[model samples]
Every structure is written in structure tokens, then in C-alpha cells.
Target chain A: AQSVAQPEDQVNVAEGNPLTVKCTYSVSGNPYLFWYVQYPNRGLQFLLKYITGDNLVKGSYGFEAEFNKSQTSFHLKKPSALVSDSALYFCAVRAQPYTGGFKTIFGAGTRLFVKA
Target chain B: DVKVTQSSRYLVKRTGEKVFLECVQDMDHENMFWYRQDPGLGLRLIYFSYDVKMKEKGDIPEGYSVSREKKERFSLILESASTNQTSMYLCASSLRLALLSYNEQFFGPGTRLTVL
Candidate 1:
């Protein structure tokens, strides 16, 4: 079974400070990981994905994630946090389909609170 | 740009009522998925359709059914809406031919259902 774990229920950071939202995964073969962000009353927006190649993948809104093969982790990072950046973050891993296509398993989510 | 749209942003229903949540994607995606989001629980897949008339149970398919009569639309059915089933429902679609590594899902704005 492919699964993702987000250890933090909530993370607090100050504006302009670096922020990290941790994520780890367990999968059968190589993992395909993704990061999504959800704002108040809005649907989730794709942040970035780690499929192949570059360990460091840049994504939208000045966000980036580093894929650590040995650690089985893909942590979302930002060099400088903004109050607007505070939102619910989700980590997901794609699972191979049994009979048809692919399925994605998502983590419980991490709520980020950036203080101004 | 890919656009996924849900039929409603908010809905209220009584217990035991039959409820339908509809999703449509403008992109010609071969795979469509339905997931429920709860606070702290993130997103749990309820059902997925790989092609028209083809549907598969996801992680939490109990108490719910789905329909995919056309390639562009997928509908989730709740036979008897229960309080426990009250949550945000999200619909997503992805290209089937894309490699597993690059099969990124585009999500709808989501429907928040309240069963009282």
C-alpha cells in the first residue's frame, strides 16, 4: 500500500522566516509525490510534484520541495513566509491501480499559520 | 488550462435523503476521482472512474455510489445521507496516458455538504 504521513498537525512561523511542512511516504516502487494547498473556503491548489529527476523541484508561489530518496521524504519549503501563505497543506502519493488506473493516497494534512 | 467544476459550493440535506454531487472537467481526461475532505483527516478517496461506464471503489466507498455515464462528467451518489458523511467533497481528473510519474490530477473547487 502506498501512503503518506504528515507528522505536524499545525506549524507556526513568522513572516519572512523560512518555513517547512514535513512529509514522508511509503510505497511499493519509486514514489510519485505531490503537494497541495487549500485556503479558507477554497479548493486545493497544486503546489508542486516530485516525479523524476531533480531532487529539488520548484513550484508555484515561491514554493519548493526536496525529494529525499533515503529519507523517503518530500518536504515543502519556502525561503520567506508570508501571512497569505498560511493554509492547509497536503501530501499525497500515487498508488498503482489494481484493475484500471492509478489512485492517490493523501496524508492527514498540516495547517500552516504564518504570523505577521 | 484545465478546469474542473463541481455542481455546488454548499449543500444542506436531511438524514436519509438521497444526494447527488456532480463534477465536470473541461479537459479530456480519462481518469476521474471523488474524494471527501474532513478536518484533520485530509482527503479520502470515495470512488474513481477510469473511463465512461467504468467505476472502482476507493478507500472509503461505503454509503456512497458513483456514476460516469459520460467522459467529461462524474457524479457521486449518497444513498442515504448521514451526519458522518457531511464533509467537503472534491472531484479531480487526470490524463490516463501520462506516465505514472507525471499523472498530475486537477481538482475542482469542491462542494461542502451538510447532512443534518
Candidate 2:
């Protein structure tokens, strides 16, 4: 079974400081990972995905994630955090439709709070 | 730009009431998904449709059913609305073609359902 784990329930960071939201996955063979962000009263927005590409993938809103094959981790990062950047972050693993079906398993989520 | 729209932003229902949550996508996507979002649990897939009338059960499909009569629209049905089922419902769509580079799912604004 493909699954994702986000260890942090909440993360606090100051504005202009680097921020990291941790994610790890367990899957057979290669894994397809994704990052999503949700704001207050809004649906989730896709940040980035790692299908089969460069380990370092850049996403929207000055966000990026590094896919570590050895560590089985895909962590979302930002060079500088902003107050507006505070939101709920989710990590997901895409399941190949052949084995089971086209299902994506998401992590429990990490609430990021950026202080101004 | 792909756009996914949900029927409502907020809803209030009573116990044992039948509830319908509708989702529509402007893009001609082959795969449509329904997920419920809770505070800590990021998103749990309730059901997914690969094509018209072809629905698949997701991680948490209990107490809920889905309909995909047309390619562009997918409807989630709650047979008997329960307090536990009260959560934010999100609709998303994506192209099924694995060969396509852009397989990211586009999401709707989400509908917050309160069952009392």
C-alpha cells in the first residue's frame, strides 16, 4: 500500500526565515509524490508533483520540494516565509491504477504558522 | 485554465436526510474525484470516477455513494447524513492519460456540510 506521513502537526516560523514541511512516503517501486496547500475556507491547491524528474522540483508561490529517493522523503521548502504563506500543507502519494486503482493517499497534514 | 466548481459553499442538513453534493469541471477530464477534508486529516477520498458511469470506491466510501452520469459532472450522495459525516467536501478532476505531462488534479472551492 502506498501511504504518506507528515510528522509535524504544526510548524512555527518567522517571516523571512526558511521553512520546511516534512513528508515521507512508503510505496513499492518508484513513487509519485505531490504537495498541496489549503487556505482558510478554501480548497486545496496543488503546489507541485514529482512523477519522474529532477529531484528538486519548483512549485507555485515560491515553493519547492526535494524528492529524496534514499530517504523516501519529499519535503516542501521555501527560502523565505511570509505571513500569508501560513496554511495547511498536505503530502500525497499517487497509486498506480493498474495494481489497485487511481487513488491518492494523503498525509494527515501539517499546519504552518508564519509569524510576522 | 482548468476550473472545477461545486454546487454549494455551505450546507446544513438534518440527520437521516439525503444529501447531494455536485461537482463539475470545465476541463474534459477523464478522472473525477470526491474527497472529504477534516481538521487534522488532510483529505480522504470518498469515491472516484474514471469515466462516465464508472465509479470506484476510495479509502472512505462507507455511508456515501456517488454518481457520474455525464463526463463533466460527478455527484456524491449521502444516504443518511450523520454528524460524523459533517466535513468539508472537495471535488477534483484530472486527465487520465498517464502519457500527459500535466496530470495534476484541479480542485473546486469545496462545500462545507454540517449535519445536525
Candidate 3:
């Protein structure tokens, strides 16, 4: 079984300031991590994914996440925050099973509040 | 651009009433999924279909059923809607079965259902 943990329930940041949302995971095999954002009453939008690549992975809306193997963490970061960035973010992980398809597990979600 | 569309944006139902939430994807993707999103629970998979008429149970399948009569459409059915079942439902589609190359899912705008 695979699980993802997002420690922060809410993160506040000022405009133009950098922001980080922490995430960690527990899985049996290679990890396929993902980040998604959801606005009020909207569905989740895929921001990025880390399948197998360099540790630092860049995503949409000027967002990026770092995959730390030893730390078992994948933290989402943005150099500058925008008021439009205020939303709910979720971290997810799926193990690459030998049985053909993968089942993704999602975290509890982190609410980001970016103030201008 | 690929788009996933849900039939309803907002739904109001009562307990013991049967509910149907429909989703369609225009990309002709091989995999389709249904998930329920809560305030803090993030996204929990209810069911997924890899192909037409083939469904698999996801994390939370109890009290919920799904149908995929066509490859482009997936339907989620709640035999008895409860207060606990009131949440935002999301639909997503992804391409798979191609040997695990990097594949991302496209999501719909979501359907907000309320069971009283």
C-alpha cells in the first residue's frame, strides 16, 4: 500500500514571496508523485508529476517540486506567490505495480492563501 | 486541448435517493476515473474503468457503483445518497497501457453534490 502525507493544513504567503508546501510519502516500490490544485468548487488540476527524472521538477503556474529520495519528500515550491494562487493543493503518489495499471493515493490537501 | 466534462455542476439530493453523476472525456483515453473530493480528505477514488464495460473498485467503493457503457463516458451511481456522501465529485481521464511512459490525467470541472 502507498500513502501520501501533507503536513500543512494552511500556508499563508505574501505576494512576490516564495512559498513551499511540504509533502511526504510511503510506498513499496518506485514512486510516481504528483501535485494538483483546486479552486473553489472546482475539480483538481494537474500541476506536475515526478516519474523518473532529475530531483528538481518544474510544473505549471511557475510551480516546482523536489523529489528527495532519502527524505521521502516531495515539496512544492514557487518563487513568487500570486493572489490567484490561493487554492487547495494536494500531493499524491502511486506505486508502479507489476500488474499493468497503477492506483494513485492522495494526501489530505494543503490550503494555500496568497495575499497581495 | 483535451477536455473532461461532467454532466452536473451542482446537485441536491435527499437520503435514500439514487444519484447518477456522468462524466465524459473527449480525448479517447483508455483509462477513466471517478473521485470524490472533500474539504480536507483531498480526492478519494470511487471507481475506475480501464476500458468499456470494465470497472474496478477504488479506495471507497461502498455504497457507490459505476458504469462505463462507452469508452468516452463513465457514470457513477450512488444507491443511497447519505449526508456523508455529500461532496464534490471529480472525473478524470488518462492514457495508459503503453508500457508506463509518462502519462498525466486531465480532469473535469467537477460536480458538487449535496445530500440532505
| Model 1 spans > 4 angstroms off | B98-101
Q: What are the per-model C-alpha RMSD values against the true structure?
A: 1.2, 1.6, 1.5
**What's the candidate order when arranged by decreasing TM-score?**
1, 2, 3
> All candidates' lDDT scores?
0.92, 0.91, 0.90
Q: Clash pairs of candidate 2? A: none
DockQ of 3: 0.65
Off-target runs (Cα >4 Å) in candidate 3 are A98-100, B99-102
lDDT of 1 by residue, B69-103 (tens): 99999999999999999899999998888535357
C-alpha lDDT (0 to 100) for residue B91 of candidate 3: 94
The deviation in Å at residue A107 for candidate 3 is: 0.8
List DockQ for all candidates: 0.67, 0.58, 0.65
Runs in model 2 lying further than 4 Å from the true structure: A98-100, B99-102
Predicted structure 2, TM vs. truth = 0.96
TM-score list, all predictions = 0.97, 0.96, 0.95
lDDT of 3 at B106: 85
Error of 1 at B8 (Å): 1.0
